[model samples]
Target: MTIKASDLLKYDITPFLFGVLYSRIMPKPTDDSNPKHFYVYTAFRTSKAVLKTAFSLSKYASRLVQQYNSLSGYPNWEIHKSSDNAIDLRLYIQNDLNIDAAQFYNLVYKKLRSSTWLNTATINEDKKYFLRGYMESRGSVDTSLKLFAQDYFYNNRFELKRVQLLTDDIGLPISYANFNPRNMQPQFVSGENKRNAQFRINLFYYAKEIGFINEYKALIFEKAYKPRARIARDGIIYFQISVPNLNSHVAFIKYINFFTNNIYDKVLTPEKVGILRKQIGFNTSQELGQPYRNKSIVDLFDELSEDKCALCGTSQTFKKKANGRQSFEIHHMIPFHNGQEFDNIANFVKLCPTCHRSLKRGSASKDDQIRSIITILGRHPEVFEYTSSALGIEELPKLAEEIWSLLG
Candidate 1:
């Protein structure tokens, strides 16, 4: 009998089966037409935790198949240690009932990637379980949460995009990064021009949404969410979460305290507070009450150029209207709506009112706008540096194209 899609739900193993299929290495199928036999082989390797999880899953699957189909035997399963000190877990299933292995694999694979399957009602739990299994197989938790698959997989880009869609459907937003071979880790590097498709989500979001099933991963995720504070050798107090690197400056300690206290309890105690206050020679609380001023875009532009338009060199005195103010505007090489992180001095440029208006969306001429953008980026190396870094664009022409699109 052919294995039907409904059998997945009938056996209550849709999520688990999909998880195994979506793993880093998918199941392999072998067929023997002479006697009408089929064999499915699934293998997994990496950590002991994954091995144990996969082993248990394999046994669970075997039991389910036996009970539901009333099979006389269970699927073969084994664990082996490789010469490289890596552990490998393998599961083999023989289907004598004439179930097509290739067809069954494709059916489950399609279900896993189907948008309709994701939107099905009462499947939230199943979705979480599916993600958990996939995470155990291919996910990693560090400063960020990442899920990756080798580039050689058939329709790898489509698969990665499906992952992004699944995460969004599950209410956890994830971003996809195209394969960059040069920056790939040694293990991920292989055949020429081969790379890996990666999906990244914020650690806090991952912890809050779909948590870990592996004991070690759970511990790491727990520790990462806890807040901690420390004093550096330079006499600066650093506040951090998940990783050791400092995220904010000493001036924002009060803000950090507020966040930690409200979210995870105050990480700093009264004793540590006293020590910090004494070392810094000030009450940390006062900084919160004091007004913190960041330089305005106009102010940043003035620092880089005279009180005139950087594009047309129109002096403020000459461009002054009846109100006695220059018509120069501060243009962002990278748009402000992208994020506040790009709201820095390097991304701002002073432009004449005419030049600024010409570069905006729905301008009269696209050529003029492109020329103006190229001129602004070429004149200011810092703007190019900041824009390129912010957008991850390398070449100036490509960066210019990206900026043009952002402007539109």
Candidate 2:
């Protein structure tokens, strides 16, 4: 109850935050004498993870948890943590409290979920954020030959028949995904080995309707996602997306390249790009080192700074390139496409290779963060001319004064 609304933004957690309100309440079981119980469960991999979960769980559920204990006159039912032989890497925490769970569960669920912050977050963006909480916790990209390979078609379309929604390893069709995962279990649904085909189809549809799926894949193109689901011969349910019109294998290659290009980042890593290059027989930009700037542009940037780094004041440059001369890198104060018409000296900052590379790593001190960006803008006078538009997030002139006062 002490949790402030603003503090909620510090962590990424979702729907289970709401779903617990709907599903975890159990009332008196045909007898009034029996104490009612409520349960909330979670898994954690590290000590910090466990602590964070405990804090979050208490923040979200503490009010109901307290009211139940107070009314029922029972001692607090603390969170229970344990590890089982069946699952490693995950330590479990379950709160089994004695209370009239059903009575308070509805009250708590409605009150919390109906809060303006949550009620307003009902669309695909909300769903995407909610799902990403899961993905960041446990999802991965499927870059296998089946998903990443060249296109195949059934009827003059770039068809990817049976694109998998979730691999069986992590246990998809879970209740969080709005599916009865139990349906795929051996003792459930008549021991059927496959289920949740509809869920998989919708999963792809959602991924496509949104531009990107997690941080790894994007929908290939507009009007290009057509999905179906089938129980594979191997008894696993697989989602299909084989309806995009692919005139040639070349077009399929282009789609894959575009996806790879967009998702390329330090997290995606150069090694994965190397593997995709070898396996898919195509390239995406180039391996992560540096973007190739024009030779004349680099020379001009170096001259503008008189061979000193605009960022860290580093002037050291080694004669390491094939030519006898040392080198520096030219950086854009604001990316060219966002506001600036083209790359030029007025929009550029000159940083020796060391400062430029170090900034890219992004694990710098606060002073470094502010000082470096300031240095870049100082060198690029054109940025001030378009300060209201550059970088696509222009602060109002009044807002700049407010920031200046705050800093003072």
Candidate 3:
């Protein structure tokens, strides 16, 4: 402060200020071309944005302070204590982490308890991490925030349905399953059986999750249809069965649509198409064609990709390898094998290797499986017909003259 003007000039304030500003603007100097530099720069930028945005929210800031206080008051909570069990330690970690309301609720699935069940030490630990994340912008807050503001609300709703069902002493009903099937009664098993009622409830849950009313209708059909036989072997099997009546084929198509719809279009993308190739591993569908004894069946399916072992209800004799390649396979629905009376497309199915082995030996019967498939397809005749036609089946189940006709 006592130095003369000349001495101050000699000190060069401009250079010193310039150096300070430069250091403030940049990270510690390093190899400019390093790949790690990009990662560091990106992280720094993202963190800075989050901090800038969150700090502006007064609620976030206030929560941050409260969490910090919780941590300081119980500093010993963070230490791993031999006296405490694993559950106690985890709870402490959750508290130290400053997990939000959303995260705490989500922890119910993993921890099997609410925050009320957690010890004071653990709660303190959770609060600390949550606050640290908010203040320092070093960890996550979005997932926790979303959990609190949104997902938790839905969780409560699901719980409500469960509670209502339990309190009413009634099984969950398919009241919301609004499917107007052309041929079949969607609710086929509406009697005094508890298991049947429970099964319907289970289908309702699956239907809700998948977000398709039509599929749910098909599922109802599935529940109504009974399997003729128990599956015995894993090997490929062949089914030579009575072709579905026109009405039955139409119904079957509806069920098949659930599996094959958007199959080529949605599933054959670069991501999923690669999986088909992997599923076909090692053997070409072409290579397996020459070895089959069922020349008529082989001739019928030979034109299509062999990698797809199951065609027209036949199981593949070969395994689906890790590389996605397939080997020798068989077709269940053979044209020559069909009786002179019935030759419908719905008669066919694809079986994998083990299924095929059992079928060639006549260990399995096709009639048994067709009954199950037909029962499921009874609903949604429109979708079912479309699928069967695509598979080169000539006939389908005849539609009723009137609507609301009950089909079983």
Candidate 4:
């Protein structure tokens, strides 16, 4: 049955889809076995589009099937990013309803594994009710899909890299990942080091079985990927593989590009978008900002968003949340409310708490803040133009003007 947004509290279908998937894809602080009394319900996106899931919560996010419960408990703070006034929701909820993660995971897995959720609701209202839930950030859907496909064909540990890195003369993943990164050149592993290596190998197999991975790449990956042996710099033998045939590689390439490219724009109708939002509790970049290639983090952030503090040259603090997340929050170079839209990361910085709060405190004069931000951003005035549409920076300080004029 076709669904109507009007009947569904005017909630756009896309954000709802995002909401449902976000709950499943974003990391959960509490687990079924952990016995934690509570979990956080954090959600805040722009009215125009959902913000990138906060970088803070991104690491723990997984592609494995997860149970999602209802939007339980009210949010405590619906504050905007003091930097750009982007919506920010961070609220903790007690396990008041005894919501079971397993049950939620099963329901979501069954519904979303193959777009069956699109048909589960009889009416638009029901779809809205079913799919609509609190959500936070976009997941690793693109990269995760590509990696699963890569493992299916190449049988290598999938590291996040450029499609170009994976592709070949024919733009396919026919190349070997013999050079997968390693920090230490030491040739040996023992104890936890050995255990972690084994775990990662196990993770490769686990990642292959994920329902979403199988749904898209099952045909091309029907044959079990064979790993050939290789000697690593660490003087250890490791499994390696690559696509042997151009045709097979092309097929795999198509599978990856399908997800990496603008599949939503090609496939989704407004009605479909609405249906997905109402049914899945989510929308994607297609509904919000321009379609973005999320798989590649290359050049995603300006130097401002780098780990160390620009102002004090302090390394990122190592404060881990009770939820086991390393603390890293996005901070805008120019204040968002000073006339900026919550734009791309070029204008943002991933900051530790001390500096993040200091810059956000509004104590510094806008002029002084601009000077500090410009320095932190490596004094590149390019972001002014990059974020100009959202930033509407009314005036740059005299120093900033000199840099901007020179850069232009």
Best by TM-score: 1
Q: Each prediction's Cα RMSD?
A: 16.8, 22.6, 28.4, 24.7
- lDDT, residue 22, model 3: 13
Q: Poorest 10 consecutive residues of model 2 by lDDT?
A: 153-162
Off by over 4 Å in 4: 1-306, 322-326, 338-341, 365-368, 379-385, 388-408
TM-score (C-alpha, index-matched) for candidate 2: 0.22
Comparing 1 with 4 on TM-score, the higher-scoring candidate is 1
Cα lDDT tens digits, model 1, 121-190, are 4437667666655554445554332222222233322232334334435433322221222212223233
Candidate 3 residues 62-167, lDDT tens each?
3333432243332222211222111111012112223333343333222312223223433232332222221122111122211100110122222212212211
lDDT (10s digit) by residue, model 2, range 161-251: 1111121112222211221122222333343343321111123433433223211122221123334533232211233554232123222
| Each prediction's TM-score versus the true structure | 0.36, 0.22, 0.18, 0.23
- Candidate 3 structure, TM-score to reference: 0.18
Better of 1 and 2 by TM-score: 1
Question: How many pairs in model 4 have backbone atoms within 3 A of each other, for residues 3 or more apart or on separate chains, i.e. clashes?
Answer: 25
CA-lDDT, candidates in order: 0.45, 0.34, 0.25, 0.31
Clashing pairs in 1: none
Error of 4 at 199 (Å): 42
Of the two candidates 3 and 4, the one with more favorable TM-score, higher being better, is: 4
> Which 10-residue window in model 1 sums to the lowest lDDT?
174-183
